[model samples]
Target: TVIDGVTNTTTTVTAGTNPNAIAVNPVTNKVYVANLNSNDVTVIDGTTNATTTVTAGTLPYAIAVNPVTNKVYVANFGSNNVTVIDGATNTTTTVAAGTSPVAIAVNPVTNKVYVANQISNNVTVIDGVTNTPTIVTVGTSPYAIAVNPVTNKVYVANQLSYNVTVIDVASNTTTTVTTGKRHNAIAVHPVTNKVYVTNQNSTNVTVIDGVTNTPTIVTTGKSPYAIAVNPVTNKVYVANYFSDNVTTVIDGVTNTTTTVTAGTNPNAIAVNPVTNKVYVANSGSDNVTVISPSIDTALPLTTAVTSSSLVNVAGISNATVSSAPAFTFTATSTYAPTAPAIRTVYYQVDSASGPWIQASGAGPFTATLPAQSKGDHVLYAFAVDGLEGGATAGSSGEGSGNSPMVGSVAAFAFSVIDPLAQIITFGANPGPVNYSPSGTFTVSATGGASGNAVSFTSTTTGVCTISGTTVTMVTAGTCTIAANQAGNTDFTAAAQVTQSITINPILPCTPGNFSATGNAPCTPAPAGSFVPTAGATAAIACAIGSYQPNSGSISCTLASVGFFVPLTASTSQTPCPLGSTTLITGASACLNLPLLNIDNSDPATVYDANTDAVLLTRYLLGYRNADLIANARGTGANLRDAAQIETHLSTYIPTNQALSPFDVDGDGVVLPMTDGLMILRRLLNPNALNVMTAAEQSAITANAKRGSLTDAQVLQRIEALKP
Candidate 1:
C-alpha cells in the first residue's frame, strides 16, 4: 500500500496492529510494514490492499531499503538480528548483529546499509553489493542512522551519549559531536543535503552540515522521537512522542516552528523526497499518519553580498547580497515591481554563493562578469522597480510555474564560449621528374580555391614561373608548382609532373642509283660507241653487218673509224636537233681510205661476231686488219688481255675463226662475212648488236638468195633484236 502524505491517508492497506515502520517501494507502490506485535512483516499490495504476512525476527522496529538491489533490511530489536528480505522473492535471511538494533539507513549512492545498535553503542555497515557486514565504532547507544546523499555520509544519533556520529561512507571513518541529550531519530534534507537529528531528552533538533559535519541545534516542543525532511521546501519535521504532535519548520533559515498533530505515539517517520511528504508510524494508535508541507514559504531576499545571492536593485552595479538579498519578482505576480531599474550581476569563487563583487559593463545593455575561481559559478540578476507605494523586484527571464525567488533575476545566468581553426587537406601528392629533357614544367592549380594562382619553379635553379587559374604547361620536366595566395610568398601547396619526349632521326638515301647525267651511259662504253653499225638505219643491217657493243668489252667507239669517215661540218642536216647527228654519205674518196678498206682487209667475207678485230689485231697481232678486233684495257675494265676475249668469243661462236687461209676468200684476205658465223654469234652475245652464228648466217644467206627475203625471216630477225 502506498502512503499519500498530502491526503493524510494510506492507499490499499487497511487498519493493521502496531505497524512499527512503513516503508514504501516507490517502484511497485507496495507498502512493507514492520509489525512489532506480530513479529512478522506484512506485504500489502498497493493497488489491491491484500495483506500477506511473512514471519520474521521478533519486534522488527526499523527497516531500510536498497532500491538498486531490491532488498530490505529490518532491524529486529528483540531478536538481535536484522531480517534481510529479498524484495523479488519475499524470502528472508537473518543476519547477526549487536544488541538492540534501533534504526537502519541505506546509502543509495553505494547501496550500503548502516544499522545503529542502540544497546551495543556501535554501528554495523552492510555492503549492498557484497552482502557483508562491517562493525564500526560510534557513540553510546547509537539509535538511528540518516545518510546524506551528496556527501555519501551516514549520521548516527547516539541516544545515551547525547551526541551524533558522522560516518564518511567512502572512507568508513567517524566523527562524533555531542548535540544535547538523548539524540534518537535522524533524517536528511534532500534539497539542502543536511542532516536533522532529534534530541529526545533536550526537546531540540540538531542540524548537521552533510558536507562539513558541523551541527546546529534547533529547539523544539517536547521530547522528539521521529524526524523527517520535506525535500521540496527543504524543511525538517520532528515528532514529539510525549506531545502527540510533530513540529514542522526549516532548520537553518527559519526562526519559528509549526506543529503537525498526528496519531498517538508517533515513533517512526519516512519522507518521500520526490513529493515532499512524510509518513509517520503511530504505534499506540495502530495506524500511520501522513503529513505535507502546509506552511512552506519563499525565502526572503538576502542583503549581504554572497556569491550565490542575486542582486535585485536597478542601476546598482557594485552590489552585495545576503540576508536582504535580491528577489526575482514576476511581472504578473503581486510581488512584481511597476518601474524599471538596472540590475547588477556577479559570481563567486568555485561556487554560486560567495562575496559579491562588481563586473565590467560593455556596449549597450551588456554586462560582462569578471573571471573568477576555476570551479563552476552562477550569476543572478534582478531589477528593483518602484510601484505606487514601495519598490519590488522585477522578473527577467525566469522559468514558469516555480516559486518567485532570487532565481527569477534577468541576465543572471550566462556561460562563456570558445573559437578554433580549420585544417586544410590536399588531393594529389608530388614526385619525380615527368619530362624527357628535364626542363622545369609550369603547372596549373585546380580543385582548390578559385582564382588562386600557382607558381612553378625548378627546385634546384630557383627559376620561377607564375601560373594563372588555368595554366598551360610549357617547358616540361620536374618542376615544383606551388599553389599560393597573393602576399603569401611562402607557398603552402605544391605538386610535380613528369613527361617523356620522343623524336625521329633524319633518314638518308636508300644507298642505290641516282645520277646527274642519265645513268653512266647504261654501261661503261667508249664515247659515241654505237650498239650496231653507227650509220645503219635498217634492222637487217644491224642483224648481220657488224659486231658492236652497248655494254661490256665489245662497246665500239666512233673515234676508231676516223680514217673511214672524217669529221665533217660542211652542212647542217636539220634532220634532228642542231647539235645532233643525221645520216650523210661520206665521199667515195674516203671509202677507199685504208681504215675503211674492208675489201683489202682480211677476206671481207668473214667476221668474228664476238671479237673486236681491230682492237685485237692492232694490240695483239700488231695490225689494224678490218677483220681483226681491238684489245684495250678500259680505265674501269675488269679484263686484262685479248686472249680472254678470244676465249670468250670461242664459247659464243662454237668455233674460233682464226686469220687462217681456210677461212679466207680468193682475195687472200678474210673479211668478217656478213652471211657467216658473225650473225649467229651476235644472237648469242647479249652485249653484241651485229655478230651472228653459222646457222644464223646460213638462214639469212638462204633468205637473200631467194631474191625477196621472206617475211618470216624478217620477223625472226626483229624478234631476236628485242631486249
Candidate 2:
C-alpha cells in the first residue's frame, strides 16, 4: 500500500501471499515486497504503479535493497539462503546463508548485505560485487538486523539470547552488546553514531552508546514491535504493538519520550525527515496515521525580474534577459518558506489557468526558457511546496502540476525573441591539424537549427585558408577556421564557432609516423595495408597474390611457391591441403596432387621396385658421390646427402603442409628412427614390415614422437601405407 502525503490518499497494489517484508530502492523508485508463503517478491514501479513478480528462495521473511548496486536481497527462512534480485534486469542469483535466515539489512555505501539467521545463530555477510557469503557468529536466534553505512557496522537483534551483536564490517569481528529482553528491532542514527534496539517483550527500548557499546534503557509504551528514526529531527518513533494506540516518540538528543495518539496496534512506522512527518501503520485498525508538527497558514513569497515591459511591436528598451542577454536567472524572493516542506518554483508561459510547470528543483534555482515566437509573452512564475507534480513536493524535472499556487505570481511582459537558436559544433576537435601531402583536409560542421548549409571561412590572415568544405594549409602556424550558417525568416543568425587549428612552425615528425632514412617524411601504413596518404590516411587492403605484413611498406610482397594467397590483404600464407599441389608462384589456389614418379632410378620414371628402393637406401644412409649412384637406375638421381634429399622431399610436401607421401607414417614429421626405418623396412621387405616385433619397434626413440604422433599412431599410418 502506497499513500499520497498531500491528499491523504491511499493506493493498494497486489502482491503474492503472506507479504511479510518490504524494502525500497529510492534511487530507482522501486518497491520490493517479500512474500513468505509464495516464496517470491513483488516489485512495484513507483511511477507507473505496475508490478513484476520475481521468484525467490522459500519463505522470504526479510528483505533489503542496496540502491547503489540496484540489487535486492531476500532472506529466506525455509531455504536457508538469500535470493538477490537485480533491479535493472529482474534476474535473480541465490546466495547460500546460515539456517533460517530471518532478517536482512544492507550497507549501500559498502555494498554489503547482512542477514540474521535465527536457527544458525549467525549473520551471513554477502559481498555485493561477487555475491559471495561469509558467516559471522552472533547471539543465539538472531532475528532483526540494521546497518550503519557511515561507520561500516552491522547490528543484529537476538531474540532468544536477549542481546545486540555489533559487527565491524571492516574487521569481521563481533562486539557483544547487552540490551533489553527479546530484541525485535534495531535502528542506527548515523550522525549521532548511536544504536537503538526495541524490546518487543518488554516495556523499554535499549540505547547502546555508539563509542562505548554500553546499553541504557529508555522507557517506552508496552510491547514495541518496530521502530524508526528521523535523522533530521533527531526524533525516534517506536511502534508499540500492545501499547493501546499510543506511540512513544523519543527525542534523540535529550533521550526523552512523548506519547502520541495513533490507530490501534501501531506495528510499523516510518518517517519523512525532510517533511518532519511521522507515518504509523496500525495493523489492528486497518489504517495509517499521519503525524506532523503544526504548520501556520502563511502564503509563500515570490518575485520576478524588474524590467520595462517590451511592447511586442518594434519598441524595445532592453532584452528580456539583459546585459548581452544570457539565459539564466536565480529564482529570487522565492525561498525561506514558513512551512517546513521542501519547496520548488514553477513557471507558465502566457497562461494562468493552465498546468504549472516547474523550471528548477530546490532553490537557489535557475530557469532556462525555451525559444519563443514573436509576441508579447507574459511568464507566470510562482513557488509551490514539495517536488513539482508531487502532491507533497512538486515534480523535479521540468515537471507538470496543478497544485495550489503558494505566492504572488510575477508577470513579465516581454517580447519573445527567437533566440540565437542555431548551435554549431565541429565534427572533430580542430586542436591540431597536419600540413603535408595535399596540404588539405575536409572539415565538417553540424547542428544548424534552421537546416541551412554551413559555410567555412579562414579566420587566420595568411597561415591557412579555406575553399568550400576543404581547409588548405598555406604555412605552419595557427589556422583558425570559422563555420557559420545564415538563419531563415523564423530564426536569427547563428553564432559561428571559430576553431584554431595549430600547425607547428618547426614541425618534428609526429608519433606514429617516423622520419625516413635521412630525416624525410615517412607515413607508414598499418600491417596488411599499404600506400598511406599524407593526412588521416586509411590504406586499402593488400591486393590478391600479395601481402604487407609490416607497416609503411612501399608495396605488397608477392606470395612465393609452396604457399598460396587466397584472401585480400593476407599477411600470412596458407598451405595446400593433403594430396594437393601448386607449382605456380604467387598462386591463389592449390590443384590436385600429381601422380608422383618415385623411381628416379636407371629407368628414370619407371619403378621396377628393386633398383629404385636401393637408390633411396643409399640416399637415406648418408651415402655421397659415386656411392649415391651405385646401381642407381636413373641418371636423374641428383639427390645425395641430407640437404639434397631434404630439397627433394620438400617438392612433394609444401610449406606448412600437414601430410605427405614421403612421411610414410603420416605423423607430420620424417624421423630416421621411426619414419626412415619404417620406409627402409617397407622397401626391403614389404611383407614382413607390418608384423615388426615390439622389441624392434623400441628403436623408434623418444625424439621421433616428441611433438608428433604416438607410436601406436605411427603403426596405424604404417598399416595405411602398406601395399
Candidate 3:
C-alpha cells in the first residue's frame, strides 16, 4: 500500500507482520526486510515489488550489509543470535550472542560485527576472523549500535537507561554518556566523528563529541527511531516513528537539526556517503524515500591522477615525473552505487599537479606517472569516491575527464638533491653550575646543528678543562668556557660561551672559652673530656696567670658567674661553670640572669660572666642559632660550633644563692668517698673513668667547680665535699 498525495488515506504492507528493520542492496537492487513475527527475512527484488521469505534467525529484527564482504547480518531477537547470510549463495551462519539481539551494524574498516542485545543490556562484539562473540556491557537495554570509521568509535543507545555507552576501539573501555530520554537510534558522521542519537520519548536528539565523550542536546520530531549520516557533507537524517515525518537534516559540525515532511512511520534510515544521499524506510507507507545532502566542497584542479593508472612512457607502473605538467585521465568502479567505491588519485606537483588518474584500491595509493619529457615534478596522492555520476574508460584510455567525488588526500613532496652539506644550526648554552663542596666540575656546552665539528676551550687551569665539546673542572673555582667550530665545519655558525662555575669548601670551628659578668660575651669553654697537649697546656698556664685572652680572643672575668678556661697538663677541664641555686632537671636549666658587658681593652675582659646571655636567649628564642652565628662570624654557619656552645652553657643555676660543692668524682653514686688519690685516678686516666661503671662516670661528670679552679683541682675539692 502507498500514501495518496491528494487524499488522507493511510496505506500499509500486506500482513507480513512486524517489519522492524529494512535495507537495500544497491548491487542486486534488492530490499531486505527483517520480520520479527515471521522469524524470517523478506527479500524483495528492487526492480520488482515481488517478495520472497528466507528462513533465518528467530525473531529477526535488524539487518546490516557489508558491500565488500557481500554478507548480510540479521539480529535474532528471540534466540539471542545473529544470522550472517552470503549474498551470492544465500547461505547462512548463525552466531550466538546475548539474551535478546535487537540491532546490528558493520564496521567498514575492520569488517567486524556488532549486535545490540536489548535484554542483556550489552552489545556482543564479534570477531570477523574467528567468528567469536565478546559481550561488552553497555547501558540498560542497548537498542542500537553505530560505528564511526574515521574515529573508530562505537556508540550504543540504551532506551531504558536514557544514555549512550561509547566504546573506544583502541582501549576497549566503556564511558556512559547521558543522552535524550529513551535513546533508540544512533548514527555517526564518518568524516566528522560526530554521533547522533534519536530519542524515542523526549522527542530530541543528542549530539556527541567522539573525541571528548561530551554530549549536546538537539531537539527533533517526536518518536525518532533511527538515524543515518551522509559522510560526503557530514549531514545527518533521522526517522521519526510517530511524527509521520523525518528530521531531514543535521549539521554534524554545528549539531543543528531540521525537520522535513515524509510518509507515516519513518522507521529506518541509511546514507550513501559517496553520493551524499539518505534513504529512509517508511514503515506505514511500506516504501523507501531518498534525499540528497547538499554538498559544498572545494575540488583540486588536478583531479585526473589516480592510484591504478599512474605510469610513464613504457606504461610501466610506479613512474616518476621531472616537472609539473597538465594531464588528465578517467575514473571508474564496478560496484553498484559505484560512487562509494574507493578510487586512487595521483598528481606530480607541489600542490595537486601533474597528470591525474584514478586507480582501483582502498586509500594511500601508489601513483603511475604520465609519459612526459620534464625538468621537475611534484607528486601528491589520495583516495576518493564517485557517488555522483561519472564516465567509465577502458584500461588504456586517457584520464582527462571529470568526476564529482569526495574523500581524503595526502600530498607528498620529494626534491632532487646534489652532494652538498645539509647544515642544521642551533643556538647552544649551558645551565648554571654553582654547587657545594670544593671539587672539579665539567659541563660540556649543549646545542648546535648536527655534523658540526665543535671544539671547546677554558680560561682557568684545573678549575676546568675542555676536550672537543666536553668541559671538565676538578677545582673549587669559577671559570668560563667557549665552544667553537672546526675550520672544516660545514657552515660558519656562531660559537657558544658558558657561564662561570663555582665550588664551596667545608671549614673547621676555632676552639676557645670565656668568663663574663652580667650577660657579658663570655665565650663558653669547650666542654666535655679534653686531652690538652703540651703546647696547649703552656698557653693555658700563661693565660691563667696573666688573665689574658687566648688565641681565639676568648676572655672571661675572674669571679664572674660564667667560666671560660682551657685545660692544662695537671688540671682536668671544668665542663660546667660555678652555679648557685636551683637543681638541674636532666642536663638543662632555666637560670634567670642579666646580660653582661664585655670589656674590649688590654685584656678585653668582661667583669660579669653572663656575657653571652642576651645572644644565647635570642638564639634559643628564635630557634635559629646557626643563622645568628653565621651573621656574627661573617662566614658560613657551622652547626658543630653551635652544638659545642649549647653543651657547656645549657645547664646553669642562679648565681645569687649559696655556693654548693662542685664535685668531679663524689656524685651520689660515688658512695661517700673523699680520697684525693681515687679522684685523681678517675680524672687522669680515662681507662679508670670507663672502668668506674656508668654510675661512677655520672658521679664524676656531675661535679661542678667554679671560680679560679682547674678541672683536676675541682676533682680534689669534689673528694673533700663527698658524703
Candidate 4:
C-alpha cells in the first residue's frame, strides 16, 4: 500500500515472500526490501510503484542503503557475507564477512558499512572506498549495528551479553555498556549522538548517551526488536514483534512513549526525517506500515530574515527595520507536502494598496532592495504547490484555476530610519606640563549636539589612560588623547579630535637640616649613607667600626674584626698583616714585638756549680781521700745545686768516716781531695796521673780515652771521677 500523505490515500503493491528488512534511497526515490525466504532483494520504484528483483546471498536478513552513494547492502546470515548492489548499474557484488552476518548499517557521510556477525560475536567494518573488511571484536552474539556519521561511532547490539558495544570508527576500539537483556536491534540519532537499543526479552528500549555511555530504559510493547531514530526530531521508533505494534519514543528533555498499531510481527523499522514519518516492516503480515507524526499547527511555516540588520524580521511576524541597506529571507515548513512546492514573499511600503511586489521566489530566498527612506513598510509570504497551482486565501490569484492548492500568508510590518551624522571637537588642547605624583589630568570635549556622549582613548596606554574626560598619567612619556562620539539614528558618526600631552620627570624628595641631598654626603660614605628617614634633620652616625658606602641608606654595615677603620664614617677598613695583633675593639695599627733565640750548649752557666762545690767542701772537709772519692762518686749527676749535694753527702756518710764521691782515680774507692787535686792536675798538665794505684790508673786511662778531649770533656771526666 502506498500512502499519499497529503490526501491520506493508500495503494497496495505485492512483493516477494518474507521481507524481513527494508531500506530506502531518498535521493533516488527507490526502496530496497530484503526477502528472507526468497533470498533476493526487491527494489521498488517509489514513483511508479514498479518492482525489480536482485539475487543476493543465502538468507538475506538485513538491508541498508547509502543514499549519497546510491548503494544498497544486504546482510546474509546463511552465506556469511554481504551483498552490495550499485543502484545505478543494478549490478551485484559479494563482500566476505564474519560468520552469520545478520544486521547491517551504513554511515552516509563516511560511506562505511558495518555488519554484525551473530555467531562470531563481532562486527565487520567494510571500507566503502576499497570494499575491504576489518573485523572488530565486540560482545557475545552481536545481532544488530548502527552508526552515527557525525560522531563516527558504531553501536552493536549484543544479544547474549545483554549490552551494546560502542566502536570508535577511526581507532576500532570498543566500549561495552550494559543494557536490558537480549538487545536485538540498535539505532543512533546522528545529531544528538544518542543510541537506541531494543531489548527483545526485556520488552524495552534502552537509550544510551554516546558521551557518557549510560543507559536509560524505557518500557515498550512485548518483544521489542527493531529500532530506528529520526536525527532531526530526535524521535526513536521501536518495532515490537509479538505485540504487533510500533512504539514511538520521543527522545527529548522528557522521554515519552506512544504506541501505534502496526502490521503483524513488526521486525524492522526506518525513519524519514524530512517527511517526519516512520516505516516498519512486518514479516507475519507481509506488509510495511507507515506512521506519520502529529502535525504542530502552531508554526506550520516559519519565516526568518537571514541577511543583515537591514530587515530585523523573523518568523513571519512584524519587526523593526534597521538602518542597514539590504537583507535575505528564509522559511521552514512543518507540514510535509506531497508534491513540489514554491514559496513566494510579497512586500509593500506604507500601505496594502496596489499590486504586491514579488520579493522572494523560494524559501530561504534572497532579494536585495534599494535602501528605503525612513518610513513604514509591510511584507507578506506564502507557499504554493507547483502541480496543483492553487493559492491560499489572501494570496495572489486566490480561488483561480491556475493558483496553487494550499498556501499560507504571513504579514510583517516594520519601520526604517535615515543614517545619522555628527561632528566632535575637543574644548582645549592639553600642553606640556610637569609630571604629577598622582598621575592625573582633566580634558573636555566641546563639539557635537547637547547630551552627546564622548569617549576618550589614548595612542600610548603606557604613558596615560583617559577615562571619560580625565587623563591619568602613568609614566614620563608623550601621548595623544582622542575624543569620539558614535552617532544615533538621527545623527551621523562624529570625527575624532586629538590632543597631545607631554609629562616631565618629577624632582627627588628634599632632605632636612644636617642631611645632604646629593648621592654622596661624607667622604667615605659614598652614595648610600645612614639617614633614618626620607627627610631627616641629621644623618645618623655609623657605629665605632661600621660604615655605609651609598647615600640614602637606612642602616650601616658592621666592620669586619680582622680589618680596622680609624676614621669615622669610613666606607672601608685596612687589614692587619700576618705577624701582627690588634685590639678587638678598634685599632689603628698592629704592634710588632722583639723575639730571642737560645743556645743549648752551655749547661754549667744554667746550673749552680759554685753552690754545689761549697756544699761538697763542707760535707768532705776532713774526710780521707778514699771516703771523699766514695762520696763524690755517690753524688753523680744529681749534684745540680749546693743544698742538694750537701743533703746527699751528709745523709749517706758512714760511721767509720766514709764519704761518697771521693774517688780520686775512678777505681771504685773513696778519695776526696786526692781525686779532686788529681783531676785538676790532669786538666792543667797533659801527662800527670801517678797518684793512684796501677789498676786505678789503667781504669782512669780507659774511661778518659776519647779522640777529641777538650777542657769541657776534661771537666765531665773529673766530675765522673768525683761521683
| lDDT on C-alpha atoms for all candidate structures | 0.51, 0.69, 0.55, 0.65
Whole-structure CA lDDT of model 4? 0.65
lDDT of 1 by residue, 212-245 (tens): 7777878786888877765534567788888887
Candidate 1 vs 4: which has more TM-score: 4
Query: How does model 3 fare in lDDT?
Result: 0.55
lDDT of 2 by residue, 89-141 (tens): 99999999999998899886678889898999999888999998998999988
Off by over 4 Å in 1: 1-17, 260-723
TM-score ranking from best candidate downward: 2, 4, 1, 3
C-alpha positional error of residue 652 in candidate 3 after TM-score superposition, expressed in Å: 99
Top-TM-score candidate index: 2
The list of candidate 3 runs beyond 4 A from truth reads 1-18, 24-31, 43-53, 273-276, 283-723
Give the winner by lDDT.
2
> Residues 296-400, candidate 3, lDDT per residue (tens digit)?
453432233433222222211233222222333333333343345555554334333235565434443444444432212234454455444434456345444
RMSD of each: 27.6, 24.0, 27.8, 27.6
